[model samples]
Each structure stands twice: as C-alpha cells, then as structure tokens.
Target: MAQNLDDNYKIAYDNKAGFGKSPALVLIDFADAYFDPGCVLYAGVDDALASALRIREVAHDKGIPVILTEVTYQPGGRNGGRFFEKAKPLSCFVKGQKTAGFAEGLVPRDDEIIVSKQYPSAFFGTSLASTLTAMGIDNVVLTGLTTSGCVRASCVDSMSHGFITTVVRDACGDRHPAPHEANLFDMNAKYADVVSEAEIIAFFRSLKGEAHG
Candidate 1:
C-alpha cells in the first residue's frame, strides 16, 4: 500500500518537524463514545475509525502527544438531537457493548494524553488550550472524522486561539465526499493550512532534521 506508506510518512514528518519545536501534534479521535450509530455522521463510520488509528500509529512513532477526546453520551446535549434521530441505532450498539466503546485500532501509549470532551470543539470546556500553551505549542496539526463537524470546529477555534492550524487533508474524510471537500476549502480559506499529506510530511521532515543538526 504505497498510499498508506506515503500517508504515514507525511504524518511522521509532521511529528518530527513539530517535535520539541514550535508546533505540537494534537490527534483527535471520534471514538464510539462520541457518536450515535444512526446519525448521518456515522455513514462512513468505518473510514473514520480507520483514519484515527492510522494517525495514532504515526504520532506514536514520532513521540508526539496524542489526545483521544471521548464524548459522553448526553441525550440532550449538543449532538443529542442527532443521536436520538439518525444515530440512535449506533448509540444503542455502543451502550450495549461491555468495554469502553472506543473506535478500533485506538491503543495510545502511556505517554499520550487522552481527553474526554462533550462538544465539537476539542478546546471547549477542556484544558486543551492551557495544555498546548504550557507546552509552547504555536501550531496545531489536526486529523479526524466528519471534516464538516468536529474537525472544522476545532480548526476554526484553533486559529482563534492563535495557533497556526493545519488540517491534514488526506488524513481526514466525511460520510460524503462533497461536504468534505466543501468544508476543507472553506477552512483553508478562512482558518487553517489545509495541506496534503505529502506536503505536511515534507515540512515535518525538514523541521526534524533541523532540530537534530
């Protein structure tokens, strides 16, 4: 899978470039605890799950901190309406599961940070902002599902928070391709550096080499 290898390379490069430098890698996952099955967002559930896992692997290899943001199932919460209507079946499956309903391929190492959130924006009502600031992070590279939703929300706020945000375009996807493309264009124009995986990887590799030399 040359494509997979290239994707991994870009992720690793981003990690290296941001490593011990100005930017920090913030990996967000739309784990099972975060979504309802019947929700329209769940249409590409498998792809979302796969992408999270792939990025997690890349981040771990580079020693970048990965934050797994878990969303609590609140019936009346921001996504509650969607949960009850479109995502009800998915929600039921997750609720019935015995273990913590994380997406597949989510095995963060001991050093990674895991955050449990309740909203679309990862920094909302969370310590993400402070954490990033404390770590001297000025740029944020984001990857995750439903590009039109959580990914977009986080990108917008990351920029507002004064972080040069980059959304790894190939690393993210949506249930439908149209919305995914539209939102990415909008975010790139107004909020983030929506670059391809290869470009990000090149940038990261250069940064990492600079640090060591």
Candidate 2:
C-alpha cells in the first residue's frame, strides 16, 4: 500500500537531533551581495532575512556565542581557489568594495566572531571547528542565505565535526524554492534538525533562563 512522507522518508532517517545545552548561533553569509536587489546573487527570499533578524535578537538576549561568515576574496580572487573560478559572482566580495561587507543589521559586534571563508563549507580552511570547540560549543544553530549551497555544506560539516546542528528553516533561503525546499528536507533527514524559527526562539529563551538563573 501507499504511505505518507512520515511513514516512508521520515521513518527511515528518523534521527531528530535535539538542541544542545551550549549551542552557538552561526549566521552564514548574510551579506550585501546576497541581499541587495540590485545585485545579481539576490535570492528574492526576504522572509529568511526577517526571520534571521528575529533570531539574532534572541541570540543577543541569551548571550549566546554568535559567529558569522563572509565570502571574501583577495584583489585578484587568488585565495578562493577553484571556487573563485567557478562562480563569477564571488567577485562581489573583493575587499574594499561596497558589496563585500555584511548586510545592514547583520553586523557582528565586538564580542562576536566573524569567520571569512572562500568556499561553501565554512569549516574547510577556516578555524570554525576549532573556534566552536574552544568556546565549548556542542551545538550549532544556523541561519543564512542560499540554503542549497553554503547553508547545506555547513550543516554537513557541522555534523561531521561532532556538533549537533540545527538549521532554522525560515531563517534560510535560496535563489529558488526548489533547491531551498529540497536541501532543507535533506538536511533534516541527515545533517541537521531543520526546525522553525519559533522553535529556535523558544530554545534561545530557555537557554537565557538557564544562563541567567
């Protein structure tokens, strides 16, 4: 007989990971090149931006460690390696350019850490894994642009690094819905527990209470 998504897909990959006690908030590439309507890389997914802002508010309130990533490259894009060759859009991140910086309101404060990366996986050549480990972070909450690319890669790497990964579904977006939905579904099944922004906010609030009280 036929079955629903739950009985078929969900049951097999029924690993629903939970939020860890010490989870770091990772904002991935929420930069001008991705959000500006005038820019070619614009994803047309504004909901994710708003959700990410809300998530950031709670992250600050809870005093959670917030980390951010930027897709920056050198003057000739020499540091990006093969990735710099493949995506011409990466030229937007050349240093000293207007579009190379983080998007407004997504800026990192003095206390937060900003990890600049040249590839999709933030942990590849960066000190992300070691930084998280140093901070005693056992879980990672992800929010960012391009769900199918950097977000997906980071989720996989986060799990492989032995950290519980959680992707705020509404806080991530793609240039299109097809890859966006497909990647989120796959991440929930394997790499991360794709959850709603409300769920993530509740989790942050819970942590705030524990941290303060």
Candidate 3:
C-alpha cells in the first residue's frame, strides 16, 4: 500500500533531474511530553525512536542539519489535554514510553537544533521557518511516526512554508498501516515529494559527487 505507492514515486523521481545536492534534512518525531501516558499520542513511540536514530546517522554523514521537533505538554498549550483527547483516540494503539525525552537521537550535537512545539505542525508557534530561512534551506526531508498525525501536519505546513518537503516513506511508520498508507498518498498528491530511503540516499550521493566535481 504505502510502500507500494512510495516505491512507484521513487522509481519515477529516480529518473528525474535536479533534486539538488546538500539539501537540508529535517526529521520530525513524536518523542516528547505530549506523547506520554494519560496525555495521549503514545502510539508509534518505538517506531519514531528507531526512525530517528537511522535518519540521524544519514543526516550526520551528509552534513545536513537535522532539526528534531517534539510536541510539548502544557496545560493550555497547543498540545494540551484538549488536542490530545481529539488526536489520541484516532491512533491505532497507544504504547507510552519515555524513549527520546529531549531529542529523537538523544544528546544533541552542538550544531543541531532541537525545537519544542506544542502542536502537530512544527512550523506553528515555532521558529522553524525562520531557522530554515536563515540556513538557506530550500528543501526539507521529513520522517517520523504516526504518518496520519504529526507527520502529516508538519508535511503540510512545511510545504506551505515554501520548502520542498519530502517524506522518506520507509523511515516513517504508523500504529496501523491503513491510515498511514492513505495519508501518505494524499500528502504526495497535494504536498511534498514522497520518496524511499534508497532513492533519497542515491540522490544525496549524486549531490556530493557534483559538489566536489
């Protein structure tokens, strides 16, 4: 389903040109307070953490900035009780665990930026847009858990913010495959370039070669 669709897109994009080199990689994850037990958004926790680690490695090697955004839990904030109640039950399952408290991959590097967000869209009520602007980041590679929720929200807003958003299909998963597959399709049709890990890696390699050539 989702993988199949993503594979199709990847095959097409692999034949295209000008994906550009040294594009910034932004990995958004649900590793924060709002996802804690009793607060809601606990499902897909494990997948998020694992995906974060894998993306972190790739981004680090490529010298790409990896911005990790988490949903904060404040009484009346965006991700407070009101929002959770609405979004939580929609999830396939809840598996609350304190995996990545601060950042997705833990112990953030001095150069990396960690954003604390209260809403699904990292661009909302955060300096993410400005940060990306300052860094001259014209493209964003998004990955994380719960493809139907935060990931979708961020991808939409990322597109709105004028960054060419791309969701790494394999690097993102959901508690259930149905919602994930459906949402990824909708997103690809409307906003963002939905691609696979192998495709993205190959694009990065091509970029590096061109930069040094």
TM-score of each: 0.71, 0.93, 0.73
Per-residue CA lDDT of model 2 for 1-213, tens digit only, reads 336875787678988889899988888888888778899887776778889888887887888888889888899998989899998898999998878898877767887889999999879899999999987889999999789999999999999999999999999999988899999989998889999999999989987453321
Per-residue alpha-carbon lDDT of candidate 3 for residues 41-110, written as tens digits (9 for 90 to 100): 4454565566556666766776777787655564333345456676653232222335335433456678
Q: Report the Cα RMSD per candidate.
A: 8.5, 2.1, 5.8
Clashes per candidate, residues 3 or more apart or on different chains: 7, 0, 0
- For model 1, how does the per-residue alpha-carbon lDDT over 101-151 read when each residue is reduced to its tens digit? 556566666776777665567888789989988776777888776688778
* Displacement of the residue 93 alpha carbon in candidate 2, Å: 1.2
- Give the winner by lDDT: 1 or 3: 3
Give candidate 3 misplaced runs (Cα > 4 Å).
1-18, 32-51, 75-106, 209-213
Q: Local error of candidate 1 at 39, Å?
A: 7.4
Q: Relative to the true structure, how large is the alpha-carbon lDDT of every model?
A: 0.64, 0.87, 0.67
lDDT of 3 at 5: 71
Q: Highest lDDT, which number? A: 2
Error of 1 at 15 (Å): 23
Instruction: Report residue 198 deviation for candidate 3 (angstroms).
Output: 1.1
Q: Weakest 10 consecutive residues, lDDT, candidate 3? A: 90-99
Q: How close is candidate 2 to the true structure, as a TM-score?
A: 0.93
Task: Order the candidate numbers by TM-score, best to worst.
Answer: 2, 3, 1
**TM-score of candidate 3 relative to the true fold:** 0.73
